[model samples]
Target: MTLILWTALGYLLGSIPFGVAITRVLGLGDLRQIGSGNIGATNVLRTGNKPAAFATLLLDSGKGAIAVLLARHFGGETAAMLAGGAAFLGHCFPVWLGFRGGKGVATFLGTLIALHWPLGLIACGVWLLSAVISRISSLSALLAAALSPVFAWAIGRADLVLVSLFMAVLIFARHRANIARLLDGSEPRIGRGKP
Candidate 1:
């Protein structure tokens, strides 16, 4: 019963779709009409509204962090892990979005931060380094997601490894199209220098 409640809470919170909501509130048309038609921070960036994009990024990450923290406070470590995983799943397949949602990279990082701050920082570093080196958003996300589980395990956070691994797999799966573009040297970079 507790697990179910935590999962439901996590999913509901994760389904907020801040990107779409923020864009609309700011007078931007349907976010789905934007680049890649994705409801993630990266897509929000294409709207030429940096403020909206930053807000989306923070809120998207906050949902996952809030779920883990709430579960940990109300339940226990195990509950926190369940909630974190649920949050990631919700981001990937939000019911509010017809089970179509953004990749779980931001939420995944957020969960990691809640579960283990050190690992989260390391993952962010990996993301930053990858982005600086490659300038490709998808590639940076992929590298960060790929490294998260390993960092968790190395830090002796065995309890977090499974959830992180699941999140990583989902992130990779969600980036399938981006992966294809990357392989063919056609993935879009982090910015257009204008929008």
Candidate 2:
């Protein structure tokens, strides 16, 4: 019962799509119509609203961090990780949004930060470097997710290895369409840069 409650709480928290909500509240219409139809920060940027995009990014990460923190406070250490994972899953497949949700990268990063501050900072660095080099947000997100588990394990967070690795997989999976576009050399680059 407790586990179910944790998962439900986590999912409910994650289902709150900040990008879509913010856009709607601000009379921006359906965010899905503007960009890649994703409710993530990258898509929000496609709207050319830098401030909104930035807010979406921060809020998305905050959702995951808050879930983990709440779990740690009310449940336990393992529960924190579990709730974080549940939040990622929710972001990937939100029930309130027809099971079509944002990619899990932002949420995963937040989860990492909640678990280990240094690892989170390193992951963000890697992500920024990848984005600058490839100019593809998807690629950057993938690389960051891929490296997160390594950093977590290397830092003696063996208990978090499996969870973080699982998170990596989930984030990677959420980028399936981007992966296809990347392979076809048609993926859109980050910001207004070249593809």
lDDT of each: 0.88, 0.86
Where does candidate 2 clash, by residue pair? none
lDDT of 1 by residue, 1-195 (tens): 998899899988888788889999999999988888889998899989988988988999999999999999999988898898899899888999999888977898898899888998899899989999988888998999988888888889887778888998989999999998888877888875312
User: Candidate 2's residue-wise lDDT over 24-130, tens digit each?
Assistant: 88778798777788998888888778899899999999898999899888988878888888888888888889999999888888988987778888899999999
Which predicted model would earn the best TM-score? Answer: 1
After TM-score superposition, the amount by which residue 191's alpha carbon in candidate 1 deviates from its true location, in angstroms, is 1.1
Query: Which residue pairs show collisions in model 1?
Result: none
Q: Give candidate 1's whole-model lDDT.
A: 0.88
